[model samples]
Target: MKLYHLPLSGHAHRAVLFLSLLGQKAELIEVDIPNGAHRTPEYLELNPFGQVPVLEDDGLVVNDSNAILVYLATKFGRKDWLPDDLKSVAKVQKWLSVAAGEIAYGPCAARLVTVFGADFRADEVIARAHRILKLIDQELEQHQFIIGDKPTIADVALYSYVVGAPEGNVDLMPYINVRHWLARIEALPGFVEFPKTAVGLRA
Candidate 1:
């Protein structure tokens, strides 16, 4: 397996982190988005979306961060991370959707403004970050992980951006349960840290 990624990208980090947690021996290839490496013909052939974090397992290509997580969980037969049952699968899928949707436009977008200078409404994105975070905090109050007591891909899906939210000026201090939940993830075996950027409120 090979993972094409950018060091600063949270999307890429999620894939890499899951690979590590699964104890997979995969080659890591850094994609130089700064130099337009991701747009090259060779790269686009692997992922037409031209995004970092494209995983190639033999000849099979998996794009999108959440999709890669599901693929790995299913391929490895790790029912703990991604269950085979209908209800459990649906619950994990919902959180993955939250990670992609609310988490993207919220914390991820805000980080883009500070870290990459991408244009976005800072106030709006930060507020959005807090809104989703508040719900997540509430959820964590009842369970140790996102879906329940066991840590799943849903937890992995939401980890990076939420942990790095302060870099985007989205405060994590007020979300105590969310903080404790993050601590639990960090203590997991084979866990990896998301590279930090000193920008936004973190500056």
Candidate 2:
């Protein structure tokens, strides 16, 4: 398997973390997003959206962090990460949606603004990020993991940005449960630290 990624992208980090946790191996190809590598003709042919974290496996190309999570969990991970039960599956799907929807707009967008100096509607984005974090904190108060007792792709999908929220000037300290939850995710086997700065991309 080959993964095209940007080292500092939380979306890309999600895939890296999943592969690491599952003890799966893949060749990593760093994409220079700032240099428009993702937009090159060769790369655009792989993913029209020109996004990082494109996974190539056995001639199949998958993009989008959450989509990649689903594919990996279904194809490679244990049943606990992508359950076969109907209700359990729906629960997992719910969190994945939250990860893609609210998490994307809030923490991810804020990080882009801080790290890349991307123009964003600051107050709106920060407030939206906090709203999502508050809900997540409440959810964590009752559950050890997102869906069930064990960690799942849902946890992997949400972990990166939420853990990196402070870089965007969004404090997780206000959410006690979330702080503990982040610690729990960090304690998982094979977990790797995310680069603290955009310049730390090589790590």
Candidate 3:
């Protein structure tokens, strides 16, 4: 298996973090997004969207980060990470959608603005980040993980951009429950960190 990724991408980091947590090994191929490597013809063949965190395994290509997490967990039979029951599965799918939709335009987009100079309205995205974060915090206030007590791919899906939210200047201090939840994931075995932004490093 090969994971084509960019170190600074939250989307990529989620996939990388999950692989480690699952004790799965894959070749790490760093896609040079800054130098147009992801936009090249060859990379386009792998992911038509030209996104980072594309996974290639045994002639199969998985294009999105959430998709990669689902694939890995299912393939490895890590039910602890990907539950098989009915209600849990539906809830997990719901959170995954949040990760892709709300989380993407929320924290992810905000971070992109500050970290990579992407042209998104900072105020808008930051507000969106806080809104979804408040809902997540409310849910996590009672449950150990997004879906329930055990950590699932839903947790992995939400972890990256949420952990990196502050880099976009969206303060996380107000969300104590969310902070605690993050600490729990970090304490898990084989956990990995999403790299701080260049600005954060210099600070």
Candidate 4:
């Protein structure tokens, strides 16, 4: 297995965390996103989308972070991480959507603005992101993980950007439950700390 990734990417971190937790080893090929290496012809052959994370398992190419999470969990992890029950599956999918949607636009995009100086209608998007965070805060008020008691792929999928919210200038202080939930995730075995952004992206 080969994982083509960028060091700073939260999406890439998801796969890294999952592989670590499962004690699975894949050749880590660091892609140079800053130099447009992902856009090169060589990388384009691997993934047309030119995304940071393109996992090549055997001969199969898997793109998309959430999809990778599902694949890894189903292929390598215990049933606990990727439950087979219909309701459990649906619950996990919901948070996967949250990770790709709300978390993507909020903390991820905000981090982009800080890192690349990319124009990100910050005023509008930040507010929308905050609303989503508040909803997550409320959800965490009663539950330890996103889906249930034990951490699942749902938590791994969402953990990166949501945990890195502080770097995106999104304050976690107001969301006490969310903070507690983050602590729980961090406390999990094989947990890894994300690198702090050096671009002064924090609020």
Best by lDDT: 1
- The lDDT of model 3 is 0.92
For each candidate in turn, give its C-alpha RMSD to the true structure in angstroms. Answer: 0.7, 2.8, 1.4, 1.4
What is the TM-score of each predicted model, taking all chains together? 0.98, 0.95, 0.97, 0.95
- Candidate 1: tens digits of C-alpha lDDT, residues 144-194: 999999999999999999998999999999999999999999999999999
**Per-residue lDDT tens digits of candidate 4, residues 6-32?**
878899999888888777889999998
Please give the lDDT score at residue 77 for candidate 4: 51
Cα RMSD for predicted model 3:
1.4
Question: What is the TM-score of candidate 4?
Answer: 0.95
Give the runs in model 2 whose Cα sits over 4 Å from its true position.
198-203
Residue 154, model 4, lDDT: 91
Clashing pairs in 4: 169-203
lDDT scores of the candidates, listed in order: 0.94, 0.87, 0.92, 0.84
lDDT of 4: 0.84
Better of 1 and 4 by TM-score: 1
lDDT of 2 by residue, 86-135 (tens): 99889888999998899999988888778888799867778988999999
Question: How far is 145's C-alpha from truth in model 1 (Å)?
Answer: 0.4
lDDT of 1: 0.94
Per-residue lDDT of model 3, residues 49-151, tens digit only: 9998999999999999999999999999898888888988899999999999999999999898889999999999999999999999999988888888889
